[model samples]
Target: MASRPSISLWFVMAADLATVVWMYTVGSWLDHTSKFTATSTLGGHHILVLVLAALAFATLAVLALITDGFTNTTPRLSLIKNLACILSVVALTGLVALILASLLSRIVFGRLRP
Candidate 1:
């Protein structure tokens, strides 16, 4: 008998593709703005690719949460599910903190007092 693809796997692939597309499109647009600096040809491409790949992996991590068998059912042979939850929470919280910091930096760009 042939095995079918798990829902989690499908979502993971989808998420990865979405992340790459989103990162590529947005990064390209951001690159066009004069305000954004790309120090070198290699550095610019590397930065964009690195950011997109990280987002893609994060998408996979999140898919693990949404998959029914992975999150709803108890693991019979391991503690991977429990670990996933903990790691996912930490990753999400860190992302939130980073976003807040970015916003704060933008708002305070010209207001820091000596």
Candidate 2:
């Protein structure tokens, strides 16, 4: 029987897609809404978001390296492989999220500034 994908993988994929969609929709809405104009700075939010994402990616990488599973293991099957796979998923997800968010923001808002 073919085994199903792991939960962490599903979470990572969902999170990546959700992050882009949420950011684009919310950013576009805030840009279009007049009431939020005085309360928030919609400009540069995408950059800020991507920066945060980069930080998160770095954090995950560091955690994976430091965690017990990765520490001086004697060639365990799941330890190194699992950590590496998880990190790969996160990295790819972050890249795709950033690209999609940027593209959608540009298309929807068109050089908006606060």
Candidate 2 Cα deviation (angstroms), residue 60: 0.8
- Overlapping backbone residue pairs in candidate 1 total 0
lDDT of 2 by residue, 1-114 (tens): 223334473355445444445555564454446443312223425334433434444444453454442333334534544554554454345345546777888999998876
User: Which pairs of residues collide in model 2?
Assistant: none
**What lDDT is obtained when candidate 1 is compared to the true structure?**
0.44
Those runs of model 1 whose alpha carbons end farther than 4 Å from true positions after fitting are 1-18, 32-43, 46-69, 72-102, 109-114
| Runs of candidate 2 exceeding 4 Å displacement | 1-44, 68-114
Clashes of 2: 0
